[model samples]
Target: MDARRGWLRFIGRRLNPLTLAAARRGSAPFTIVRHRGRRSGTIYETPIIVARRGPDFAAELTYGQSVQWYRNIRAAGGRCELARGDEGWQIESVESLPVAEGLAAYGPPRSWVLRLLRRHEFLLLRVEGSGGDASD
Candidate 1:
């Protein structure tokens, strides 16, 4: 949350494809996410990087668990189109993944150990309906 990094994020949001693409290749760089626009219901994309989590494949979100993308997928429940490879996958909104389990997936834990050690509070939504996950 340094001022300089914050400023870069603000400016990065405005860069075009060519420049943004270049940035994505840099260290711990950004990844553009193409999601259905919340207000317009049209498709739009935003660039962000993996915030570091305790798991693999599952990236750590830098913002609050209640962030817009976090909330949107929680509401709509759809796939995330990753920018780099233009690959897409089914996404699940999970607020809880046992610390060790997530740690095994992501990393051994450094400063982010706090995230892993935290008490989890998440709402699980199934890819399908009630028949798949819970009786409710």
Candidate 2:
């Protein structure tokens, strides 16, 4: 696990800058998550894949729950900003969704890949003013 984490970190560092640029351009499957550091209070923008489920969004926890962005968002009252193309949303809440339920938010191919990769954890974000249950 440590080795995998190291590899992911290495790859992420190299790819993040490029990914962030594309994400800022409003690329599909890429969303820019703006969050603050839990300790340093420094702001960070992370690129992630998100799937819309009703008025909410679901993000696969590809790096599990221990990722810095996840921790920071959770620590800071589950509030963050998500930008996709020219659209933006104020995420009001974040919560873990059961594997089965979360998987339903994604299409078959993505769900299958995530399952094959053993990435079962997912975060469900509720957008402010977007009413309706997450399960809808």
lDDT of 2 at 79: 95
Candidate 1: residue pairs that collide: 54-102, 55-105, 55-106, 56-105, 56-106
**What C-alpha lDDT values do all the predictions have?**
0.47, 0.88
What digit string (tens of lDDT, one per residue) describes model 1 on residues 5-102? Answer: 67656665666365447535642356555566557677655565443331213344544465556555555554545454443333443344444544
Model 1 CA deviation exceeding 4 Å by range: 1-29, 50-56, 90-95, 108-136
lDDT of 1 at 100: 52
Model 1 lDDT-worst window of ten: 121-130
Residue pairs with colliding backbones in model 2 are: 26-85
